[model samples]
Target: MPAHAPARPLEIAAAGPLRGTVRVPGDKSISHRSLMFGALAIGRTTVDGLLEGEDVLATAAAMRAMGARIDRGDDGRWTIDGVGVGGLMQPEQALDMGNSGTSTRLLMGLLASHRLTATFVGDASLSKRPMGRVIEPLSAMGAEFTASPGGRLPLTMRGLVPAVPIEYTLPVASAQVKSAILLAGLNTPGITTVIEPVPTRDHSERMLAGFGAELTVEPSPAGRVIRIRGEAELKPQSIVVPGDPSSAAFWLVAASIVPGSDVTVLNVGMNPTRSGIVTALRLMGADIEALAEREVGGEPVADLRVRHAPLSGIEVPPDLAPSMIDEYPVLFVAAAFASGRTIARGAEELRVKESDRIAAMAAALSAIGARVEEVEDGMIIDGTGGDPLAGGATITTHLDHRIAMSLSVAAQHCRAPVTLDDAAPVATSYPGFFSTLDALAGVALK
Candidate 1:
């Protein structure tokens, strides 16, 4: 709710048993895509359960600047009137994307093939993150850009009309890069094909097809082949976003580490591409059960009932990295209280997040008395066998939301309160996190 990502310092201590059913914010990934697809579709598209987080709000603002009409009704549904493909107008001013990498990248893709030019800027954190991954490929498609050094933001982009289409293979496993190319393909002349060497989240592919875009997927020796026909028209859809599993992971890890805890997270997205946290936790000997498994809004859904159990660390499978990329901070926290050493490998992607998560967690966890060391790609953490950590240090959040919340969850087994310097970044993905943590801890945050 703050005008910017402020520093809201808070001290987190072990609360009485975490016991409750909580629905965290709607999926931030899905929320951003819903608004984007809605703004690309003709007529009216209504979205229910959209995350009102500042990240998603930044997306809404960008769409509005491009001449789309977006508003939320009293029923908590967001309605969008799109400008359709190739219909975007040049914005009057630079788009301030706040702390969302997802919004900035995806919107860049959407703007790449249109006949418009827009400048973009973000807060300190986002400005430091690399935009080269999105820029290099979009530049290949003839989109010209003037960026800060290393393709960082505070940049201006000139979209190419009737853009050239090319087949690009992903060098890394990133849903954002793939979606950007596919979104730019919307107005391209020929087919825009993306070859993904590693499968990441498939929300864009599934949602694009649902919205009447011509998209397809096939297995290839290299990896997977995805093709999108250009000049596509998107049909408006009524979308319901599922609860963010990334947010659910905090409670999952909290209940797993804190003794006498029982928590159930409801309506969480169980999409295979994004459920690596559940898998990695299970590998670490977590006592989690999937209850009431069902399908919702084209994605798998389940209620995860997590109870406190003694966990033993394992060598996290490298294949699980892409599925749970957003969850490593808390996964690191989960490892801190496990029985043995937990090694997370093949997760070089952590280096480029809102913060260098691996280094950040290594430094923070070590300072809080956990035996932690950073590797080039991942991290190694020696656990405390469920013992409370001797904590009395201020951990900096670095304008990263997950860093702020992961430490909060880590405080479950701390002897003293763990102070976070910037709890405000949590507003980007999970605004109700503290309140929900309060309710489970038997306190009223209000």
Candidate 2:
């Protein structure tokens, strides 16, 4: 069994409006993709602004085991010399992906079509997460998996000889699942297709093309059909990862929900494919100004200047859930302080993420004295609507990164301090979160 050394839990207190210019870390999605694509490409892929979080580091370790050479430069950039398509060597040891579902699932796809066997292990949190979704789809493509009972991790994957391509339609909207199948197709001999009914993040498709993979997307009545021609050589190129929109989401909600607050988050990745939270916040009457919009590394980027606003709640469209699936915890925090009611639908995906986000958010909101109702798929939050939150409680984070960040930010608008238990899990994504927020609040962690 593997153990992670835990950091001391910190208490965050509510303070006045935050004013500062802080550049957030690189995008986690892009960081993971860069390592995956770089490992599968033919030449050295240099990445600038890659997120150095634990989740992404796990992905880098997996790539190194598969025969890719990943090195970090003195200037904080990473360079990867890949093993190329069909060139990966069998790893000598079990791949420990820690608590990263993205790393585990996507690697399953890559392993599914290769001519080797690999075993994956993770922390208790990742070990408990279901791998059945990736297992079932990759199995259909001729991969064999033996997991713990209930399809959990510490699993072994034996790739099939003469692997077959698959036409898979995702039962749920998951980018990890989508990316897994797409990667499996890269080593197969024919066209592999995946149909996503609700649009999830398209970073995989975009990065695949950038790596010189033969991929195409066509709109269909059922959903968007993505087809990739198998057995194509991937050519490596330089990539600059964008700032994480999910991380920016916390700052966005904090600035709008806290009184007398005004802050601008710069160079945020605003890929329309991942902008559901912005749309939802705008619908709830957030005062957000998009400035100097431009393109970077084939994705949209902009400076978001957000100010305190009187927010009112509205029903978030269920179909839009895929774009901002990870932002719901913070969205719930914003909703807790809004004027009316905020209802979320089509969020069954939240049940399987880092923790049961839906349940966690409901409990925390209720604990902080906000009236919250948890539905099977989503939640109904009746806001104090800018009323100072009663917030003298410790929230259990359940090893979920977004949960801890959301509660930490939720304390900003409360009448009392908010403490989250087990915030050490936040290193999976936003590593500098508490220090950054503390700098903004002009206070020390006490």
Mark the regions of model 2 whose C-alpha exceeds 4 Å error after superposition: none
Quantify all predictions' global Cα lDDT against the true fold: 0.91, 0.90
Segments in model 1 whose C-alpha atoms lie over 4 Å from true places: 1-6, 443-446
lDDT (Cα) of model 2:
0.90
Best of the candidates, lDDT: 1
The lDDT, on a scale of 0 to 1, for candidate 1 is 0.91
Q: On residues 1-446, what C-alpha lDDT tens digit does candidate 1 reach at each position?
A: 11454467887777668998998779989999999998989989999999999999999999999999999999999999998988888899889999989999999999999989999899888888999999999999999999999999888999998899999999989999999999999999889999999999999998999899999999999999999999999999999899999999999999999899999999999999999999999998999999999987798989999999999999999999999999999999999999999999999999999999989888889878899889999999999998989887889878899998898888878887888887888888888888899889863221
- Residue 401 in model 1: shift from native, Å? 0.5
lDDT tens readout by residue for model 2, 1-446 = 46866755878888788777777889999999999889888889999999999999999999998899999999998999998888889999999899899999999999899989999999888888898989998999999999988999889999975689889999988999999999999999989999999888999999999889999999999999999999989998899888899999999999898888888888889999898999999999999998999988899999899998999999999877989999989999999999999998789889988889999999988998999999999999999969888998989888888999999888998888888787899888989988889877764467
Root-mean-square deviation (CA) per prediction: 1.7, 1.0
Show pairs that collide, candidate 1: none
